[model samples]
Target: MGANATTLHPNVASGGAYDHMKLNNGIKYSFTYELRPGSGSSWGFELPENQIAPTIEETFASLWKFAEEIYADDNATGRK
Candidate 1:
């Protein structure tokens, strides 16, 4: 799916580089996520056309979950 279009690829729906496989069930999804050498941090999420927009709580919870995943990954290194 194009960035300008409403339909989203599973990668975009999930968080691009941080894709968590949150795609709709029963459908196979695959994407290769790589951060280019000069790229800065970026994030994204997919709100399916059938699902309502996330509530403030849902958004925050998802954010925290993503943060935790990063914190847990051995490859993620930075100031503690």
Candidate 2:
């Protein structure tokens, strides 16, 4: 897998870090996710590509769901 491509390994870290592992073999799927650092007391988001919301949504929804767990509600919420 390349830095810019993977079935896993979204930028799942925010104000933190972790490891991503993919065990399923031959399961080729494209997934995308965005992790914004939300400690600036500003609006933040963890969207899966807004331009093609549906495509990105469908592909990465599962990964995004688990990824979000690492970030606390406030960190991801962008609350001031």
- Please report the candidate that would top TM-score against the real structure: 1
RMSD of each: 14.9, 15.3
Most accurate candidate by lDDT? 2
Instruction: List residue ranges in candidate 1 displaced over 4 A.
Output: 1-54, 75-80
Q: Could you give candidate 2's per-residue lDDT for residues 6-77 as a string of tens digits?
A: 323346522221212222343223233444432563445543355456655655775676557535554677
Q: Rate the local accuracy (lDDT) of all candidates.
A: 0.41, 0.43
Task: Quote the positional error of residue 73 for candidate 2 in Å.
Answer: 39
Give the C-alpha miss distance for residue 27 in model 2, angstroms.
1.1
Worst 10 residues of 2 by lDDT: 13-22
Q: Which lDDT value does model 2 have at 70?
A: 39
The lDDT, on a scale of 0 to 1, for candidate 1 is 0.41
Candidate 2 lands at a TM-score of 0.21
